[model samples]
Target: MHELQALGKQLVELPAKQLVDIPLSEKTRDAIVAARSFKHGAIRRQLQYIGSLMPKEDEDAIRIMLYKLQQPHKDEVRAFHQLEQWRDQLLLGDQDLLNELAIKFENFDRQHIRQLIRNAKKEQEQNKPPKSARLLFKYLTEMQGK
Candidate 1:
């Protein structure tokens, strides 16, 4: 019951746009919206009321939706890590990875990638800033859109 009340508090705190994505009954949704306008003890009572209504809901589904809303960038973070790995592999002279990238992206410019790799290598040896590495990552991100 305490957990359900806590989840209700989280629901009430969410913006209307995010709340819309959540599966909620009309009565519960109205209570949450009203709770937003409440003050002091009234909001607590409303949260308890919402909690009482939660047993009729699919709790797991609501939890999953809340997780997705709270961590919207989870997938994007994973993809960014993937791009960084690709950039690192290219810098390491992984020719097979390079060939794989070429086969994957139709607009993959082998010459441009090669040039960026060489510049990145030079920067690493000279202890300079990794300008080319950043550009390579940017290029890879653009390729993702195509």
Candidate 2:
């Protein structure tokens, strides 16, 4: 019963697009849609009603699908962090770091990288928008694909 309610609550928290992807019976889907308009006690009751309907569906499969849906977001966050680390290293490290990047990426444009680093440093010193830093990140991402 508690598990059902918990699943119902999770469903309520999902976005409409994702909610559509979950394999739910017509009755359960209608209950979920109706639950969105509910408030306070009524919402709680609707959630309980959804929970009561859970036993007739494949709960495990639904949970696994939700977990799968969330995995790509985690991967994207990991990729973003990796790019940030590389950008920071490029900004702070000496010439050897640039040389290392050049060796790692065959298409690395040394002159352009140096230009961006200089502009980024100037922007930082002036407390301006990090235009060059963003460009450096974009360049790195493009290079990574090649």
Candidate 3:
């Protein structure tokens, strides 16, 4: 079936270390490893063979494991977007936003944040590199870590 082939393809794409982490049988692992080195038609046939073997294995469990592996990357991207939103809000010269940040971050350096905002705005106007914006992002990230 197409779903089985797709699962086989996913397995082929996984790194060896990740494959090891999954609860695959030794036979399935060996088949996948061998398939990795095959060329063109041989690789396709090997993948189909792996697909045939999938029914005997716990296909749902393998898919769940793959999803778990990808979850952290999604979390990181979401966090980065949140940081960008915060940076943009601060750059918009909203004093209330800064107050909210100060309240949230306790030891937030108000003077440094204001200075970075000014420099970032100047850099944007002059079409220069965003050195100050990067500094601001780094500061915010560090504060979040704490």
Candidate 4:
């Protein structure tokens, strides 16, 4: 019963577009939509109502679909973290890693990277804004697409 309420809370948090993808009954969907417009105590009561309605639905299927919907976001976050790690490593003068990146990205421009790194280093030493570092990140993002 509590688990159902928790699932109901998760369902309510989903955007309308995502809610459309989940297989929900009209009544449950209506309840969720209504809950979205409610104030605090009313929303809590609505969630309890939704939880009560959850038992009739296939819990496993809904859970699976929810996981599937969230997976792409998780993957994107992981990739962004990897890019940040790569950027940090490059800034630390990882020549071997830079060489590896050159091989990995066919469009990699070593000279451009060198210029960016030099500018970034100079900016750091001079206490200027990290304009080049941001450009490096933007370049890396484009490189990632290819």
Candidate 5:
């Protein structure tokens, strides 16, 4: 299992151009292009929703340094692939791996990450009938105990 703190630190240190790739799955890339082409607010909102799951850390400094590296470019699709490469290089592929690794360093394991990811996805997936922010916040607060 991956150390969440270590992963957080790495994410914080990564350049914005690199971070942009983090959310860029192949499907995400298609959605982004389709969104930009049509100014599709819904797609953009969905992308933003997925992006929201990422820990909002202080990577803004690195992004400022690498600001020019990212733009609405023709190779935006390539960025998606690059992001996938980074995910692989980051070695975040397997839940079991992360859990096993994390246990060596911390008490928490993949089950927690899986739960968090699952809940986040469920939150986004059930967009129409999702829990209110207050309830979500309550759940998140409870998760801290585990």
Candidate 6:
């Protein structure tokens, strides 16, 4: 399995503690951490590399950015397609300008992820059953798949 798919699968299937047991090689785990820790063109590069490892998966990791950023569905999917293109490489012609956009977009993505975690924890706390971390992980992981 490619690192991207493995990480994505882990993000979805494994609980937080179990995620650490997903058996990723150190390099693959490092790559996963790197990709998640920063929002940049590296995400595409990492996806491509992961896809390369798993020849069966040519599909790039599009939702990595979208899910992490918790962006809403805009008028059309093209907006997201274009945004990913901009991040992956400046299809826009200028590198420096795109770098600025990447930074701002990355910041938004980070904030979105933080807010999601906070909201989920808050909701869990108010629930009749009182969600556990494992349950919270399951909810988060499942939602990201969509």
Highest-scoring model, TM-score: 4
Q: In the order shown, what is each candidate's alpha-carbon RMSD?
A: 4.0, 2.6, 2.0, 1.0, 19.3, 19.6
Cα lDDT tens digits, model 5, 1-146, are 13333333343444545756554345533433444334456644644543443234334553443444445443665655543443332233455645544554445444544564455456657884433333433433343335
Model 4 CA lDDT for position 64: 95
- Give the alpha carbon lDDT tens digit for every residue of 49-129 in model 1: 999998888899999999988786788898899999999999999999999999999999999999999999999899999
Question: Residue 146: error of model 2 in Å?
Answer: 4.2
RMSD over all Cα atoms, model 3: 2.0
Off by over 4 Å in 2: 94-100
Better of 2 and 4 by TM-score: 4
Q: Give the TM-score of candidate 6.
A: 0.27
Tens-place lDDT per residue, model 4, 58-114, is 899899999999999999999999888888888999999899999999999999998
| Evaluation by lDDT, superior candidate among 2 and 5 | 2
Candidate 2 similarity to native, TM-score:
0.79
- Per-residue alpha-carbon lDDT of candidate 2 for residues 21-133, written as tens digits (9 for 90 to 100): 99999999899988888899999999999999999999988999889888889988898888788889889956787888899999999999989999999999999999999
Error of 1 at 64 (Å): 5.4
Write down the lDDT of every candidate, Cα atoms only. 0.93, 0.90, 0.91, 0.93, 0.44, 0.45
Q: Compare candidates 5 and 6 on lDDT and give the better one.
A: 6
TM-score of each: 0.68, 0.79, 0.86, 0.95, 0.22, 0.27
lDDT of 3 by residue, 61-120 (tens): 998999998789899999999999899889998799899989999889999999999999
Order the numbered candidates by TM-score, best leading.
4, 3, 2, 1, 6, 5
